[model samples]
Target: MWSRELEGVCDEEYELDCPACGGGLFVAFGSYGTFAAAGDYVGRGAVGEEGRAELAPADPDRLEGVGARLHRAAVGAGRTQVARALTYVFGEGRCPSCDVVFSVREQVEQR
Candidate 1:
């Protein structure tokens, strides 16, 4: 097995081509805070507010975990294989419908 890491405290969203049915799949990455600050909650408030009110962006160098999810649609445009900047989670899967090949690239947690 290989290692994977989150880029930073950011939300990344994109559509990927489904290898099985040639359909469209939506992939999203949720905000990832630093390892030391993972359980802290961010609340809406003034920038200078103390405690949870003070929101500091996540640092990739100190990250440990990231949130992500994927969804499939019945009717959507198909996409071809291409190289592009994408946020990849640490996992692998295949197209169930078409029995096609799909892969997740090797990644390292930034921290």
Candidate 2:
């Protein structure tokens, strides 16, 4: 199962004003390091069900607080099953700097 966990803050905190409307937005670490939320961690995606476990923290960045242990019983059990894993945890939007619509990846792929 895939779980949404907190990592850390962005290396560089950036504040950009929307060129279209002059609205400003602060780009910082939301709840998780990779996620960027203006209000809450609406980016949490549950990889396990009630009484079920979630995935173990495979990455060091995800070992913050009480990490989840995901059971494999849920659907989409592998790295190839990313789309299902990121269903709720992520949102697609355009970059404030470049105005490029990009898919914000939830998991940091190991090289």
Best-performing candidate as measured by TM-score? 1
Residue by residue across 1-111, what tens digits does model 2's lDDT show?
223232211221223333334434333332333322222222465222221212212342342232222212222355323322333223333343345443332322110
Error of 1 at 61 (Å): 16
For every model shown, what is its TM-score relative to the native structure? Answer: 0.26, 0.23
Which ranges of candidate 1 are over 4 A from the true structure?
1-9, 31-88, 93-101, 106-111
The 10-residue segment with the lowest total lDDT in model 1: 74-83
The deviation in Å at residue 67 for candidate 2 is 15
Best by lDDT: 2
